[model samples]
Each structure stands twice: as structure tokens, then as C-alpha cells.
Target chain A: MSIWEYANPKKFMQTSGLLLPWVTGLAAIALVVGLIWGFFFTPADYRQGATVKIIFLHVPAALMAINGWLMMLVASLIWLIRRHHVSALSAKAAAPIGMTMTLIALVTGAIWGQPMWGTWWAWDPRLTSFMILFLFYLGYIALWHAIEDPDTAADLTSVLCMVGSVFAILSRYAVLFWNQGLHQGASLSMDKTQHISNVFWFPLIVCMGGFVLLFVALLLLRTRTEIRARRLQALLLRERMA
Target chain B: MLPELGKYAATVLGAYALAILLIVGLVVLSLRQATRMRDRLRDVEERVKE
Candidate 1:
């Protein structure tokens, strides 16, 4: 069957309901194992010391924060093009989760930076762009609530999502574009020389996997709730009309 | 037993605490909303049938 068939609400619900338990279980396992490994078993950095452990949460949260927005951007695009309610609701469902990720990243980054950089905050390009991304998330969520009509809210937020995507891209690559930032270069990169050492790398990869799985599980759950809420609204409206 | 975190014990622990708190809060809120929506939808569906 074509992928679009799942765009239908019933099919989407059926598949997601079956998938949710498995995804949630895997996410929990990965997160528990990864965090315990990173926190208790990993060696401290010579320079950064135990503060290095914060990387487990910071990097993964930062990655998901950006990726969550990208997911919403794609969903928004689909809604704009295909006029699928599921796509629109999915975008709506993703915003708060993205915002929380962004908040986690920022807070953890600040805590890590306090010792490493001798400061808790900076206007460095990467940090600044991430802050902007957080604001975009807030604006996107606020726009949804402000509009009473679902379709109109979806339309406006889709446009907003498109506009905010530029900043998201900027946030993702600001380190590359600006070399002078206090923020360090990527921990995981294609260049082996630039990559973090294997000692810390393995558990980090696991943590990243956990974060991704967690995002998927949360997205499915939230999207199903949004769909149900929409259906309830429709049923109430029908009853009123009758 | 906790790993020896040196002078940054507070810092490391604080970050983990905050992050975990936020994540748990988000999960609880989402689950609560999902349950509420599910129950409301079921009730409406039942009333409509009646």
C-alpha cells in the first residue's frame, strides 16, 4: 500500500497504537542503559573532568531539539501541500516536545559551560541561534492556540514553520559558519581526527539512539491524542447540529 | 554509590536533576492529556450512539 494510505486517521491510529508499546519499551531500555553507562562507568576527561558527563544529555537533547523542528517542518510542508489533517496535527504535537528538548540543551549547555568556559551564558553564534530556535517553538505553539479554527491555525503555523526553518538551519550550522564562538566544534563528526575518542563515544551514540527513540515514542503518543481530540470536536459539533 | 565528581559535583548533579525533571514533567503532562482526550472522546462517542 502507498504511504499516503496511512495518512488516513483510522489507519494512522491503528498502526501507531500497535507500534507505541514497542517503541516506548525500546526507548526506556536504551535511555536507562546509556545514561547509567555514561554517568557511572565512563572515565572523566583530563581537562573537563566529570562535567563531561553532561554531554550525554546535552548533545542528545540538542540534536533532538533541532531534529524535532525539522520533523515539524516536513509535517507542516505535507499539510500545506496535501491538506492532510494528520500531518497538521503531527506538527502541532511536535512543538512542545521540541521546545522541551531545546530547553534541556540550553540548560545543560550552560551548566557544562560554567566550568569549561568560566561562564554560564554567551552570545556566541551557536548558542544565540539555539535560543532563537527555542523562541520559534514558543511562537509556533502560541500561534496554534491563538487561532480558534484548526485549518487556519495549521495554515498559519505551517507558514511560520517554513519561516522558522531558516533559523533552525542556522542553529545547526552556526558553529561551522562562525569559527570564533566559545562553543566547541562537533563532538561527533565524519572526520575521525575530529571525533570524540572511543572511550566516550560508544555510550554517547547509545544516548543519541535513546533520545531519537524517545522522540518517536512521544510523537506517536501526542499525535494520537491530537487526532482523538479532533474527532471529539467533530462529534460534538455533529451532535449540536442534530 | 555516585561516581566521584570532584569539585563539579553540584554542577553535574544539578544538570542531570533539571534535565530529568523536565523530561519527566513532559511525559506526565502528555500522558495525562492523552488519557483525558481518550476518555472524553469515548464518552462523546457513547452519547452519540445513545
Candidate 2:
């Protein structure tokens, strides 16, 4: 059976329905454990002090915010190239989740920065690009509602996703292209020297895993709902025609 | 037991609380919406079939 078989809506519903509970359960456990460990057990950072704890939430949410958009970009490309309805619907399903992730990161970042940077807001390149990313999400959602034709909306949103990718890249790498602002360089990297110290690393990784699983479970649930809506629309159209 | 979070205790706790609120809220809302959508779809399908 090809992987694309799961793209069939019925197959998808069955598979994702089975998988959702397990994924959600794992996410809950991991998130709870990671946050507890990071907040209670981990020592305060020497440089930043107690507020360093916010990284547990802020970093993971930030990472998901970017990665979620990247996922939509890929799904959009798949939909455009392959004409897979499920792929398009999956992209639609992911937007709100991605938007929420972006908001969480922005708010948490501001809170963390207030104590560390001594200011709540700045026109830093990273911050500005993230705000742009948020706008892209809102515009994408708006496009979906503005267009009544599902296929046309999918086409337009697919194009929007492609365009938004450039801004997402700018958002992610703005720290590198411009001078680094209040945001720190990526501490987590494939390079061994750049990996975060173990005290913070373990729970951070766990928390990130939890966030990813949460994203997956939610995406599946939302996608299933979208598919059902589409089916209902089709049936109604048929009834009208008959 | 809550550990001493120094002067930033409120801020730290607030951040966590907000994250929890948002994440849990999303999960609950999404699940409820899905269930409702499923029910509505079933009803429409039945009507369309009839």
C-alpha cells in the first residue's frame, strides 16, 4: 500500500482516529513532565536568573510556529502538484494551530524579554518578521473565508503559502541576516558544540516533542472535520441537483 | 510544592499558566468542534440519503 493511500479521506479518518488518542496522551505526559522538571528541578540560569524558565514554553512554541508554517508550505505544494484534496485540507487545518503557536511564542518572548532585556518590545528584525508571519496566517485564513469556491480558495491559499514561505524564512533567519538583536543565536544545533547544556537540554527536548505531538493530533482532528464538512457540502449539492 | 522563583515568581507562573490555558483551551475546543461537526454531518447525510 502506497503512503498516498492514507490520503484517501476514509483511510485517513480511520488511521488518524486510531492514532489521535495515543498521540494526545503522549503529548500530555511529555509536556507535564518536561514543564515540571524545567520549572521546579532545574536551577536558575547564572546570567538570566529565574525568568530563564520561560524558555521551556517560548522556545518550543516558537519552533512549532515556524515548523508548522513549513509543514503547510509542503502540504500546499503537494496539493498543487498532485491535486490531493486531503493535502489542501491538511494545510487549512494547520493554520489556526500555527497561528496559536505564533501567538504563544510572541507573548512568552515578550514576557521573558522584559526581565532579561529590560524592555517589553523592540523593532528587532526577528520580532518584526514574526509579526509578519502572524499577518500571513491571518491573511491566509481570511482568503479561505473570502472565497466561496473551495477549489479556488485552495488554489489562492496555496499561492499565498508559497509567498509566505519567503517571509517565514526571513523571520527565521533574520537574526543571521541582520545584526543579532535581543534574541540569542540558536543554541540548539546539529553541531555538538552548540547544543544547549544538559541541565536545560533534556526537558527542552521533551517539551518540544510534546508540542510536536500535540500539533499532529490537532491537525488530524481538524483535517477530519474539514473532510466531513466537504462531504456534507457535496451531498447537499447532489440533493439540490436531484 | 512550588519552589522559590525569586522576584520573578509571578511572571514565571503567569507564563506557564497562560501556556497551559491556551494549549488546553485549543485541545478542548477542537475536540468539541470535531464532535459537533461529525454529528451534523451524520444528520445531513441521513437527510440527503432519504
Candidate 3:
């Protein structure tokens, strides 16, 4: 009847199950096409040369790394205010995915940096903030594991998410605020091309789309598992009581 | 066909390789967890029914 109705485990499971194959198929196609096109088809930058090819993976992974945390923040808020079990589990389900994205971005950035910046690492504002954001993600996940009661864990993580969001925002805007970063200004922008050539741009966009779909497919799969695990725990507890 | 990457071939290829490994690893682990939890839950449900 409503969006929240799908939050019911049965509905969520059935709906996601039907959608999984489609999402997975689309993600595979896009990722394959985008990566192949970007890697083999596009011309090397006049300045950065072939090292620029790394942007396809680095930028999208970095974008998703931040967006994933933001998604968890929203989900955590919903759990705290609306008391939705799905929301809490969704937040939980997303953390590992987010963490992986962050790691991907970091690794890719460092690899790219070695060619461009002549260094594998830097303690600049953007890079440092991102590292802090990764630490926040680690702490949030650790807190979830440390608590036994689901509600308590959800509540604590929700508060932590809210708190971590402030630092995340700072991390995102650190380049703008500090202006002392080895990281360059944003490559993509809404108002203009931001120096990204069309040959490179389209494939990068496609890759980002693929990553988004991949994130959704993964979130759905993980959330459903968490729901099933919770259900099993409840059932076992019931059997014991009976 | 693979494009020539000049001197930066290792950097480009290594980044892609690491990304592939991480993404594939995550997907495999998540799917396995889902399958495992579902199977375990189903088994318990069947046992209780008996």
C-alpha cells in the first residue's frame, strides 16, 4: 500500500529478489563497457598521459565512498526517528560496502598519485579528511558489533552516524576551506565540463552509474540477509521459550 | 586490444586489478553470507516443524 509496506521482510525479499537479476545484469554490462571503453578507447591526457586512465576507477569509487556513508546516515536517522527495523539493518548492511568503497578509493588514489604527484601518499587536507572518514566508518561498525541488543546498537550507531556526518562534511569541504591540498579540485561539475573531455567523460559517467547499481544490488542482498538472520534469531528464541 | 600505456602501464593496470579484486571479493563474500544465513534459517525452521 505504501513505501514502508515494502519494509516488511516478505515484501522486501520478494521485490528485491525479482530486481536482483536485472540490477546485476545492468551493472555488469555497464561496468564492463565503461572500463573497457575508458581504458582502451580514450586517448591519454596531454599532460598526465596514461596515468589519467586511473580516474575512471578512482573518481567513481571516491564518489560512492562518500555517498554510501551519507546513505547510512540517512538510514540511521530513519531508524532512530521512525523505528524501522529495515532502516537500521540497511544502515548496517551498507557499512561494509561503504568501507570497501573507501578502501578502493584510497588505493586507487595512491596508485594514481604515484604517477601524477610523484608520491604514493600525502597528508594533505582532502587525503587526511578521507582517512578520518574511513576511521569514522570503522568506529561505527565496531560500535554495532560491540552492542548486543539490536535496538541499542541501532540507536548508538544512529547517534554516531549523525555525529560522524559533521566530520564527513568537513572532509568533503576541506579542500575548499583549507586550499592546501595535494588533491586537485573536483574534476566533474554540474555547470560546466570542468576540463574533462567528452571522450573520457561519457565512459566515466557510465562507470559511475554501474557502481551505483552495484551498490544497490549489494545493499539489497546484504539487508535481506540481515533481516533473515534477525528472523532466525527470533525464531530460535521463541522455540527456546516454548 | 590493449592500448599502450607507455611507462605508466603498471600504475593503470595495478589500480584496475586492485579495484577488481576488492569489488569481486566484496560481492562474493556478501552473496555467500546471504546464502549461508538463508540456509541455516531454513534448516532451523524445518527442524522446529519436525
Give the best candidate by TM-score. 1
Question: Tens-digit lDDT track for model 1 on A15-129?
Answer: 9999999999999999999999999999889999999999999999999999999999999999999999999999999999999999999999999998899999999999999
- Report per-prediction Cα RMSD to one decimal: 0.6, 1.2, 1.2
Looking at model 1, give its docking quality level: high
Please give, as one word, the docking class of candidate 3: high
Docking class of 2: medium
Model 1 misplacement above 4 A: none
**Per-candidate local distance difference test:** 0.96, 0.90, 0.90
Residue-wise C-alpha lDDT for candidate 3, range A22-116, written one tens digit per residue: 99899899999999988999998999999888999988888888888899999998898889999899999999998899899999999999878
Give one digit per residue, the lDDT tens place, for model 2 in B1-46: 9877899997898888888888888889889989999999999888
- Model 2 Cα shift for residue B14 (angstroms): 1.6
Could you tell me which residue pairs clash in candidate 3?
none
Cα lDDT over the full model 2:
0.90
DockQ of candidates 1 onward, in order? 0.93, 0.78, 0.89
Higher DockQ: candidate 1 or 2? 1
Off by over 4 Å in 2: none
lDDT of 2 by residue, A164-239 (tens): 9887888889888788577777758888778878899999999999899889989999999999999988988888
